[model samples]
Target: MPQNKKFGTFAGVFTPSVLTILGVIMYMRLGWVVGNAGLIGAIVIIIIAHVIAVTTGLSVSSVATDKKIGAGGIYYVLSRSMGIPIGGSIGIALFVGTAFSIALYLIGFAESFNAYLGFGTTISDLRLTGTIALSALTILALISTSVALKTQFIILAAIGISLISICFGSTEFVPTTVHFFSTENAVPLEVVFAVFFPAVTGFTAGIAMSGDLENPKRSIPRGTLYAIGVGLLVYLFLAVFMAYTIDAEVLKTDYNILMKIALFAPAVVAGIWGATLSSALGGILGGPRILQAMSMDKVTPTFFSKGKGQNNEPVNALFLAFVIAEVGILIGELDIIARVVSMFYLTAYGFINISFFLESWANPDFQPKFKVKRWIGLIGFIACFTIMFKLDMIAMIAALAIISAMYFGLQRKEVKLQSNDVWKSVWENVVNKGLKRIDAQVEENSNWNPNIILFSGKSDHQKYLLELCKTVSGRTGIVTNFKLILDKENSKPPLKKIDQIVRDEQFKDLGIFARQIKVDNIYNGIKNIASTFGFSGVEPNTIMMGWPKGIENSEEYSKMTQALIHLDYNLLYLDFDRVSKFGNYSSVDFWWRETDSKNAEMMLNIARFIIASPRWNDTNIRVLFVNNNNVDVSIIETKISKLVEDLRVNVNIKIINNAVEQKTFYTIIEEESIATNLTIVGIPDFNPEKQAEFVLKTNSLFESIGSTLLVKAAQNFNELDLDLLNK
Candidate 1:
């Protein structure tokens, strides 16, 4: 579903989520609090916060680089190693937390806007502005997807303007007498720690956007750490400026801290206003992307997968986020909600770190590309939860209630899905990791590109298969699998030579992989293989055969194709007419049936594979979707539109009214069957009732073809192998 040209790595990962977190903070409020703690104490808080942020960032990074990441992102990793149910619960939690974030940000924006308008700050004023803020949030959520390209522009501009304004406005202001360290006016350490805890929480927020990162393994750590480093420096500078310029009594008062500084230099108001607005926009736009990813994976409702338009934007999810956040703003208010958000996030951090440790030690087969001494994860966990005790117990109670409701109402399904072993392990890791970083398994790497794996039987032709696997294993790391299905029904003698050769050669190759199994039939056999491996569904980007041999052109090809149509897996037929010599093809093309499982998946795979091949570098891939009278025209248009949006490959949709007149149908088919690479058509195995409809549309098209590939829904390559030979 992604475009062939790679997206910029800069804005995808860190910019959206991190900026949302950092920008949302009431900078002047923080400055005033830190100034009250005196310069030396404020620096200590900054130092501790950065250390925690860096440690957590390293933990998150290590888990991300271990393997291929999905667009479903970090949740996919957790779901894969864990189970669907635990991952689902975490997805729900993230959705709620992100929604709350949107609401809290909008509330901040409205309050800031009212204050800037010279309206006095009051609960009534905030509530009145909440109404307008909700409307704005809704509008922004809807438009966010359509104008996704402009988000980076808006965020970068806001960050630059706010930073410059803050620096210039506070430059000339200094107090008559400054205290670097003073116990006389200092707040209790417990209270100071409680208020200071939320400051560093924003730094690790970048991990939340794991779904969008172009290179999350590298970018998430860099962006998260950078945000913390910059935020700490900014916090330190503002604290010193406030302590040096503003009197102690004035700094302790309820007056807007930034506004007081604005009086000394009028420009600071613009920076405060800009920061609040950017924070809201960032949350409104960024959070929905993850929701969209989850929806596509079927963890949430299917509606999220149906985005506003192009880019698969989750319009419904965004709207829901806005509604939840607006209610939070109206009920919890800014200060209370901000603290609750911090608490919820700290809980999430703890779980994620636990997930990281489990990934390394629990699975000895999976070693991390980056890791920490076990004590670092332990201390980071402790540091996070320790601050929660200092939070307003009332807010913490409210957060716990929300979490419990989420667990019972939404996550209960997940709890049922997990094994006792999984639950016990997760809980043990969570407790051991400490309370600081909650383990929601938020580790996602968006850097790994999508790939297509071609599967074939590993037997007498193992040598040829190995060569093909090596050929496709170019720069993109195209994966090919050799699957051998032993028929238990036949109960034939096992091949000792084949087994030895498989181990010494195919498995011996640095990149080639193989699997052998005994089963009833190829179809069921490969399905078992797919299930054994960690693939959700049929793994959309897979080709189920190498070459169908010994079977003459007959009903067998059509039957195999028909069965595949039901399974919805891509069928690749090596063209005997065009590239029969093997490894010397000049071009590759694909035909499409209207009911084919999303042509984008197949087309992208074909395009990427062909582009990497020396045999077909300049090839042009083709897609032909048959539109018949029986098929709904609107559905055809929607499918065509989606294909165009998702892939750059050329596709032609043939609208056939009827084949009642065989002559006319034959003419159309002959025209389509001219000099071409390959013709792909979906075989009819699904929708038995629609068999009549499919025959009317596709039968004539199938019979009058060129080098046609009867696409069917088969299991993995293992099933396809036996299906081909038996048919």
Candidate 2:
């Protein structure tokens, strides 16, 4: 176990997050936002931005409390909750954006430093100053993170002094009245949101330090929520105070209006520099650890993953971060497109919300102590993405595109899978609960649809049976390709090639589910699966099998048939003599036998299922009966006519008045079935003691028919089949 250096909640999480939250935006831009958007609009903007922060904070806390959040902070919670692919994409984007954020702050610091010292200097000279300051901060970070965090306390004190001066001078600089909603000469509402939005963006600064914290799981939630609460109240107070005290014109144009609005102007000036520098320090400190963690995971170059510093700081990672920041400083004028860079952070926040939502929705083991309603995460996800697009749709989209590209690139590296998150288990729970409920409800005949499991031996050889499965299944029913492995060791059979064949475009119109299950024997396998193959509102109610071919022992298949009978399953056995032989279906034969035969109804149902498809559109169905001489033809003909009328299917009925000898029945069927493409027959007997004889006799029926379907209908097949069986 990798251990973290121990620290309390305030130093490890609260101080960093709070100081960053109260950074350069609070000092330089809050007044401008209030001036442009007016009191209420600024308040609205602040609330909108902070609502995202507050909700994200809650989501982060909930995830953190449930998991041991070590190295990688927000990425830890995310990667643990979601998978590595999603987390790595968002994590890398966040690290780059955050690393670039250091350059942004340092540039601000350079300009402010130049103006404060009254030096009339060129932009290049200011760039040099910013580069030097960044290098120094990087060194400080490499020396020790604890030291940098300690320095933030002093900076926080300066911010406190500035806040006091600004509030005190609010009363001193006030006019008698104020306009709450004035937007005279203000920028667009989108621009106003853009200006004020960064105020809440620093909320995740603490999350970057997840590795170094003693009790990260405990500290992250308490510290993050506290910072957001503090940040929200402080922003609201400043927005309201600035609206009433300062003139709108000065607030709009003057970036340093806070200095003039302060009772002690120099203290607020110090606060501005202090806040910007501290915010830069926070990013500089946090960025390396993220890189270091990713390196250890082998997502990035492993050299940066291990630090060489005695204090256990990420020395190599810090230098590499410095290299990136220095390059940004050299690039100069990064400020013009700084807003675009912020897109990555917003996208990262959105992903954070999505991660928590997926965990809560899918993972059954996600028992967080700080549970919020699931919609909170969902709303936060929407809000973040919405705000991102609203600001710069192109930049937001481009950032996502790059992240997705990076995700695929990283996936090629083959990172080890390590998430213990519960999302998949939760999905299983949902499916199982849904199916149990469905099974409990009374099944109606109108709602009945075939959810057939096809046991086609080497499905490739039985193309006719496969096509029949598709046809009988129709659009409303399900057809699954089930392959049983008959091995004692339960080894996985090579089924990918065959799966690809089924998944090919030639069979694209067919909706079929496929799985290969391993068991010691075939009958036990079928029994186990027939009893349990179901999900959500679907269950395997019917078993469709081709005529058994490669069976060395027929007793196993006999047991399988017996098991299905006991389980009350509808069984379909087909003898497919090649699909090419079914070139054009001219006729479908439904054999009507005894008056009370259950097979008659099921065979007719099967015939109906096939003829409804466009493949059999030109075919006419024939209901033929070879009756005994003593039977009345007109009475049975009338009964058949009524059955056809109730079913609404086109059929021609034919009665053979001459009786045939029982010994020559096979020869008679052989001649009569020559013109038909498909013959449907019902089996009435399953002699339990004579399973082998029954199997042989049943197999003999296919010798005369072209593509024969032998159905053994269940006795209690809902109300409709029960009524048919009783009659």
Candidate 3:
């Protein structure tokens, strides 16, 4: 595009907008609106329509001034502000709406031209004329946007003369027949508003030409607002003037009432022709730009991105838009096309307001040169959709469903937006405030949730361990996996960042926060990170690690376990069996011992978390107690059943009698849980002096079972409650 040839405010923005607004709807439909709605009702509809238009115009101006808007005016503003998914959805809708708008204008022109030729308005005649007009307009648009826009000045002059003729022709006030509200035969007010709305939507014609403007920030706000102001004044004046001069019956039935009522009927006819032709030309010029912009963003096919000449005119996109408009014209009904176009414009306008509202509310850096109250965007958003539902509920739902489908489809493409989105800032602000609120509250045992920190030395080698932690955390709790690198040189290797990235990609869907920590000693690193990892509100309450392998690091491992206990962190050591690796995921065995009730409680809670996961939803849970002290087995079973019932968990209880001394506790465990998917066993107190002995005994105890969890509670609180477990 040539820099010097870029358009200024009047030619680029004001002319196109005002011409579009005063096009087909003004000449053809305004009298019908006045006839059905009457004078007072028409004014109300006009006010309501303009309120939405003015607010949206303000929001568009605010957003445009905040950033240097690119091509695809509304699409660029929304996608840049909100993100690609939502932007793509609304962009496609806007493009389709604009294309349909071309057909709308062409159809209106054909209807008026057919009447002027004394051919009478017929479906076949309108379709034939509309198709021909579409071909001519598409050719004109293909030739040059600059040329098409330049001709809008003549259309504006014609509209001016037509308005003058209407005002002067109304020599006598002969109203008093039309009701303030609608008559019994009048269509619903919302239906009337829906048809009239497309008239005001022409303000976006200038915004669609954002790429061709020299200074969009100044041009868009000034041009768009001025056009809306002019369109509003003209519509309101015509509504009152027509209601006072013409009979309601004549206004209601005649689509050519404006020409009949004008001082010089030929001027009104010329204005109608100029208005419809220019508006169709504007749609042809603007719609393709939106498609081209989306194609460039990779939201649509790249073929449409190719443009012709120095202006990079979207010729290919224009052809596609022309095809869509042709289909709309083939439908061959004006009101049906009007309703469809109305839905598309409403969807676009609603999102524009939402985009501006989110930018203003979420981003502190969103300081626009042309400032408006943020609530104005919010109200604009509400009004646009409110009118949509009031007009047609089924169409409203269909429009939303289509946008939603497009949104999810674009999400799959993962299109990366170039500009910064406000969602990140919005979420960050929400989390910060939420954390502060959580910190201000007093800690309670009943409200305890598992915030687990896993120390995985090599993430690739610990996939099963990571999966276990993720399952227990599920969607409610928090899990952070820290890969510890023992670097003696104390250098932060670049590979560590790459490793973190790889880990993220590997488990991206798991929602686990993975980090890499370089340390001189594993024990000190664990202690240091555990001491100051997170804030008071959401600190890690559990430290998870793989079971100790050999005697070489037994002392350090034992000391770290003791330190974690001292720091009030629950410990979980997983002794995963490489062979059986959670066999079939059918059943879980919880070996409950009366001496360590705290560990039992923790084990029960972890079991609940496991069962909550979809993968383990059908897994049977069995709490087993070995009777060694000759206590009543029936009483113990009853007590266990009552406890499980109180926790609202369904589980089977098995109390095995120690009939012989030769069948050891470890032997019973090996035999009972050998075929189970998972086994939960409590961790005994770690004796620093006998670290090697403890590791060997515990490791050998779970050697024959499937994947086992050795849980150790750091502190004794109230018994596990239903609230904490369910949460």
Candidate 3 C-alpha lDDT tens digits along 1-727: 3464699999999999999999999999998898898889999989998988999999999999998799998999888888999999999999999999999999999999999988757888899999999999888888877788888998899999988987777444366675577898998888888888888889989999999999999999999999999999989888887887888777788998788777998999999999999999888889999999999999999999999888899999999999999999998888889989999999999999988988998898898999999999999999999998899899999999999999999999899975788889789878888899989988766634889998885644488888888887756889888877788777765354556543556557777788887788888889998998988678889998887677534667667777888999988889888888878888999886655567777776777788888888899999988876666766777677777776667788898877556476678899898888888887766457777766777778767777888888867544432221112
The window of 10 residues in a row where model 2 has the poorest summed lDDT is: 718-727
Comparison by lDDT, 1 against 3, better one: 3
Candidate 2, 1-727: lDDT as tens digits: 5543566789878988888889767876787788787788888899998988988899888999887776877776777777676777777877887787777677767766777787644779768888889988887876777788899889889999989988777455564556577566787767777656666867678888888888787888889999899999999998888888887777787777777767898888788888888888988888888888877777778898887644357777888778877766665653342564457678888888877877787776788888877789999999999988888898788888998897788677667556664557667878777778977888665433788988755645566677788887866888887777678876766446555234444345566776766668877878888988876578677898876754524777767778899888888888776643564877788776653266666666666777788888778888887665535777667777877676676788987654545534445566778667887766666476676665666567565568877777776442222122223
Off by over 4 Å in 2: 1-5, 118-129, 170-177, 182-184, 323-338, 360-364, 367-375, 389-414, 447-449, 456-538, 549-568, 578-727
C-alpha RMSD values across all candidates = 24.5, 7.1, 3.8
TM-score of every candidate relative to the true structure: 0.52, 0.75, 0.90
Cα lDDT tens digits, model 1, 1-727, are 7562223335654555455545545453565455566678767766675666666666666666765555555455555545555455555665566667666666666666677688856777776776676676568657653354345556566556655665555433455777666457666654554455555655434555555556666776567666666666766776776677666556655335565445333444555555655556655665665577667656678787776454556677777777777777776366566655667666655555555656555554555566566566566666666655555567556665665565465445443333222345666555555433423344242221323344566356545544444543445444546456557576776445456234545545545545454555665545544434424322333444554543333444445445445554455443233333232344444544434454335444445555676656665655444444345555655656555555554444444444354344335555765555444444534545454455455545544444454444333221111011111
Instruction: Answer with 2 or 3, whichever has the higher TM-score.
Output: 3
What candidate 3 gets wrong by more than 4 Å, as runs, is 1-3, 38-41, 170-175, 408-411, 414-418, 459-461, 488-504, 626-639, 656-668, 684-693, 720-727
1 or 2: which has the higher lDDT? Answer: 2
